[model samples]
Target: MSRAQNETYLLPFDNRIEINPALAGLNKNSSYQTGNQYHFVNSEQTYNLFYASWDSYSNKLKGGVALNFSQGMLSGQNISTSAIGFYYSGFPIKINNSRILLSAGTEVLAATKHWAVAFLNNVIPHDNDAPIEQGESFFRYYIFKPKFGFLWTNNSLQIGITSTVLHTRDVAFSLIEPTTTLGYTLYVSKKVDKRVRDLYSRPFEMSPELVVFYREEATIARLRLLAEYTDKTWGAFVQNDFTNHISTLGGTIGYRHNFMRFNLNAGMGIPGISDYNSFMCELSLNIIVPPFSHSKYNPWAPAKN
Candidate 1:
């Protein structure tokens, strides 16, 4: 029997001059038999990421950078990987308030893996008793990957196309093939009420959104429908994703106080032919620093002059 677990998420809202940091962990285990011998393989990974982005008013131009570090351990062997990347996006042309934007990014990564060769030799019988000299304990490599994308947005509707890992160099220690293909997304959202008030004297609104994602590499598509209700101090949302004839339900709750906001989200996978018992949880915090000036043009300015 084998089991694997993974979790990933990207910030949903658009922000100018935003800074975000996150951490993730994964675990997988499997067992196999070679002839009369049986072996178990267990792997674990952890990642840390820091990202910062800035966008111009009306979202005409944007740029960002990200730094990532990851470590993986499999059967006592350890591998480490790190990357730094930058991206630029802009709406070079616009028509009647409808805009089209192009974005491109690249990342440079370095990886190293350390293996225990002598320990492996003891586990598996050798044909000859000849002494085995200790070879290189570790190997290092590098990779460069590029990404490009385009987006078109008008009012409440948006369409986007993106390509990732356009150029990827093979890593000798990698356990899985990198996904290097094109993907598409569609988003539509609508606000239910524009004139409700909350306890904090802030506008209360409810928005429902539908988003779809498709990947050419796997010929797989997923659809998500979400409804969010928010005020100045708190917000909540419920969403569901439909894929491969299965649906997953999830919800989020968030609170804002002073300059900081906190959010918590969780999801559970629904069962199909095989009983599924998978669930994920995530927590995030955001800090807002008001711009120095109120002019919409200067994001760093205070709103009131």
Candidate 2:
């Protein structure tokens, strides 16, 4: 419905889409990183509730919800600023596979409001809103992470290396800059009993990873091919979206069964389909479950020096 309503008022969370990975892998990898035999669950499992959203149609209220600091207003609109991200990565070594993780988050909003409040988790319209003057997460950019990966599963194949900082400042409304991102994953599990179910459920996996994205001047890359099914409750993945080669082709759909994990990531741009054809949707939630490596032991087990 936006024909041209440029009121110089852009703080509705800048409308969100794809969201760069929306905190990546749920805590650090999306639904696709169930690699290294599904280890690395450093704990920090929130989502009793977290909020964000924005859809469009500005004079006020189009898909409402948005929140960063929240001043008030949802449908009538008026909370002009937002940003809240708190991620946790655990597994300092309770035993099992050697793993370490530290995920961080922080945000500020304006130009309308950022992430549009992350889509109704804040409760409102439904589909992005929030921005006041965002130049891409203005003033306060956050993401300080530390990760170490290891897996040597009797030679079937499993490799790991991770580092993420995407962008950060010392704190509050901070936008220090330079940005950095590099991630990795590899998987192998082929039990495949194929009778009905339950022999470890039905295993067959092949995951390849090389995701490096850095932004200051520039750098972006991706190479992810995954297929998985790991369970405690549920974890699933199906991916085939090469970053470039004309954006190649894209596909991703995830469901983390039960406690609540859902990702409907999208990307289908073969030159914007005639003029503008886009696909990017993310509705993430992990409100609070912070403490990891499977809480006590067997985080997947791969650290025995």
Top-scoring candidate (lDDT)? 1
Please give, for residues 60-119, the per-residue lDDT of candidate 1 as tens digits.
233322233223322223444455555555534577976666666665665544345546
Cα lDDT tens digits for candidate 2, 66-172: 11222212222222223343322232232364333222333332224324543333455334344332223322323333333332222233333333343333232
Candidate of highest TM-score: 1
Misplaced by over 4 Å in model 1 are: 1-81, 109-143, 173-202, 209-247, 273-275, 288-305
Local error of candidate 2 at residue 278 (angstroms): 30
Q: What is the Å distance of residue 180 in model 2 from its true position? A: 30
Q: Over all chains combined, what TM-score does candidate 2 have?
A: 0.20
What is the Cα-based lDDT of residue 51 in candidate 1? 33
Candidate lDDT (C-alpha), each: 0.39, 0.30
In model 2, the worst 10-residue window by lDDT is: 33-42
